[model samples]
Target: MSERRRQFDRDGFLVLPGFASPEACAGLVAAAERIVAETDVDALETIFDAKGQGHGRDRWFLDSGPEVRAFLEDTPEGPKRVNKLGHALHDRVPEFRAFSDDPRLDALVRELGVAAPRLLQSMLIFKYPRVGGEVPAHQDASYLYTEPVSVIGLWFALEEATLENGCLEALPGSHRLGLRSRYRRDGDRAFTERLDPRPWPRAGWRPLPVPAGTLVVLHGLLAHRSAANRSPDPRRAYALHVIDAETEYAADNWLQRPADMPLRGFSTPA
Candidate 1:
């Protein structure tokens, strides 16, 4: 395994500097703009594309919508899947190739006691101003029901991720805890009311500070989330989800099986 993997295994995640570069980030942003522009907004009148738009059923997102449509978009009864942003980003870029692969990332998983590794889902999470919101403190594995929590996520920040603009905060070594106590479903929560996420209180909360082109790779069981975008400008991050080869596609979760498209660090799975 690569030294990068060693760092991740020890720290739950690592922030690699300049993974893509400003030029590459610009390319991803431009590609996203094209998708929004070409999208048929009129066809999609009352649309909603917040978080996990497509789980069991396909989500409806209009070309120009500030937020979810309240009714249709809220309450994720079905499995939660990444929204159109993921689909578009995956369709455009070609730099996300080694984010999940490479001898390092692959070895890290194998060393985790899992057999082979296969990417299950990947998506781009763009944060809009004002309306774009915060993700509560919770573990990524909570939403993922697959036992063993072998699935992990790679977060690629396309823009400067600062505290003012809402950076991702992770609980150091949270992955070692192995799916920290889950929470019961409350009507208030959106998607993750079913699982435990710090059902009790904790200390030593840390926020990740990484600039554009930086990648924050974490274990699937890691506890982390981000705040709302408060910066005057927009912040965008491409969230790519990868699963171990031993994992089977359970009928319950949302799956992103994009066609042979060109995306950075993700065109081909290792």
Candidate 2:
């Protein structure tokens, strides 16, 4: 195995500083903002309120809007925000689609021994200031289960991710523990159960703070989670999940949508 792959294998995750250029990251953020501004309330209701229902191509999925609104103070403020906007931006939005098809990411996945890695899911997680929800420690395989559990996450920071703003925290080498039972979910739109019965050493958890444009590659079985944003600034990031094309993606996976398609390979970036 290559040195980089070895490092990831040992740590269950790898942080690549400045993986995306500043200009690229800015463009992505702008695209997300535009999606929110242009999306109508009807669309938002359909995406956020309707559980397990799939919106047509290139639509924003606003699963967390109601919760965010409920948590908002009564003062007149900006409109409510959702926890994420995705699962299909890669296939629909030009900028996101371009980023998804970026050859450098595919090359890295290939280097990690994932021959023909296919894109499984894409999400732009919004950790809104103060009201951002905490994600419980869990494994990606719990949601993206495959025969050998080939799913891997490429999480890119679109803005500075700091501990005060809920940066990702992971337990190094935790992937060795193998798959654990998944957190129960009411529907595709609800918060995942935060508590897992399995005991984890709290001391081993490490917070990873990365600047905009950095990429964090994670193993599917790695135990990781992020806290709620307590700071006044928002924490925004893009996460793309991919799996080996050779594996069978079970139909029962929680993220399944009718728009789902086969993962495609991209050429290396210049």
Candidate 3:
């Protein structure tokens, strides 16, 4: 087994500093900035608060499985700020597509035992300067669930992620804690159903402040969270969630796509 796989198995997450080039990170940041600049905030009313009630069940949030869509948020600074551009940024944006299709990702997943990995979801998360909200500690499997829990997250830092700018903090070996809840859709409504009542640890989370172009690989069931950005600079990141193609994706999982929009693997051309 590769060293990275061994480390991930032990820690539930891996930080690969400088995994991406400086130029690549800059390109992604520029693309996301352009999208935000062009967006009409006044028309976008639904907010994307991860800690909100029902986890945002509106049509604008629920129906963004196949296309690129933007979600706004009301921060300490103000309302209507772009919270994230998600679901299919990699599939729709040329600049994002190029970065998402990097061959190194293919080899990395294979080494980690993710055979026939499929790209399940993508998002550019924005931690707006002095306004980004706190992301509650949670497991990724609760959202993008699979039969055997095959989901994994590749979070790339497009800018410096520091303590002041809300870098990621993770509980080592927390994947073994098992899934705590499921974010499900029933009819048109969405809700989180508790599967385990065990409380997350109050301490022991290790902060992962990293430089630009760093990649943080997270296990599906890992417990991770980030604080509100209080610095002058914004913290930008591109997150890709992948799952083993062989696993059975739960039908009730909140994010769903039409049959025509089949999931693509790293080996498949964009």
Candidate 4:
């Protein structure tokens, strides 16, 4: 069996404890906090309120907020404020890039059997105390499209993720069964079409129990969702999507990438 098969079988999810360190998490937290703090130099636009926490009369229900957008504040012109801290924190850092394309990261993907990996997208997710974000039951591929159904998602914990803080909960091994067709006005085509909703057999359903600093690599088809931050503390996770390198992007815009992108030979970016 492959390393991924073993890990997924044993723990339902693979937790590379300490994949990220406390110190590293601290810096990121501070940087993100600065962005939340409204300031003159850093005026943000929309905060993309995932929970609709501070929505006003004008706020609308978006399927999903911008992958990267400005952080909002309490003022009337709040939503217009760019996510100053978020943008600055990630944009100015070399580590984020390094981590995203890290050879070790690629190796983990290889270990998972994703022959060649393609860097798709990356984003930082933060769930604050009692912020309980609502995530409908569905596998990621139900929302994202990638070839071969072998896209590996690397979620790096930036804080001590606990049940209270609402860590990412996933049903592992579900990828083997293939994608589930789901429907959402704002859902990804990968799962937009309605198929069998039942995650049958109960043999492949594995819910993850991950800790802070750990890297959990999961197949995109694996069913997963972020739990609500029910505790007084906050939970932060940075996720990056890497697909089998033979993967292709055949679209003009991001919302839609062509299902068929040309494939390349076996090679590592490292």
Clashes (N, CA, C under 3 Å) per candidate: 19, 0, 0, 16
User: What ranges in model 1 sit over 4 Å off?
Assistant: 1-3, 41-84, 87-115, 180-202, 256-270
Model 2 alpha-carbon miss at residue 267, Å: 5.2
* lDDT digits (tens) for residues 69-141 of candidate 2: 1111111254555656757667667788888888788899888767778877777787888867677777888
- Judged by TM-score relative to the true structure, which candidate is superior, 3 or 4? 3
- State the lDDT of candidate 4 residue by residue for 151-265, as single tens digits: 6667788877776677767665666666676323323221145577664454544445566778887667776666666789767677766667565532321233233522222
Name every residue pair that clashes in candidate 3: none
Cand. 2 Cα-lDDT: 0.73
Candidate 1 structure, TM-score to reference: 0.69
Could you tell me how far off, in angstroms, the CA of residue 64 lies in candidate 2 after the best superposition? 14
- Relative to the true structure, how large is the alpha-carbon lDDT of every model? 0.56, 0.73, 0.89, 0.53
lDDT of 1: 0.56
Over 35-136, each residue of candidate 1 has an lDDT whose tens digit, in order, gives: 556655334322233344333233432211112121221223532222235433332344444343446555545665457566544555656554346776
Scored by lDDT, the top model is 3
lDDT of 3 by residue, 77-160 (tens): 566688889889878888988899888998888788788888889999998997777888999999999999999999999999
Per-prediction TM-score to the true structure, in the order listed? 0.69, 0.80, 0.97, 0.68
Query: How would the candidate models be sorted by lDDT, starting from the highest?
Result: 3, 2, 1, 4
Question: How large an RMSD does model 1 have?
Answer: 7.4
Q: By summed lDDT, which 10 consecutive residues of candidate 3 come out lowest?
A: 71-80
List the lowest-lDDT window of 10 residues for candidate 1.
Answer: 62-71
With candidate 2 superimposed using the best TM-score fit, by how many Å does residue 206's alpha carbon deviate from the native?
0.6
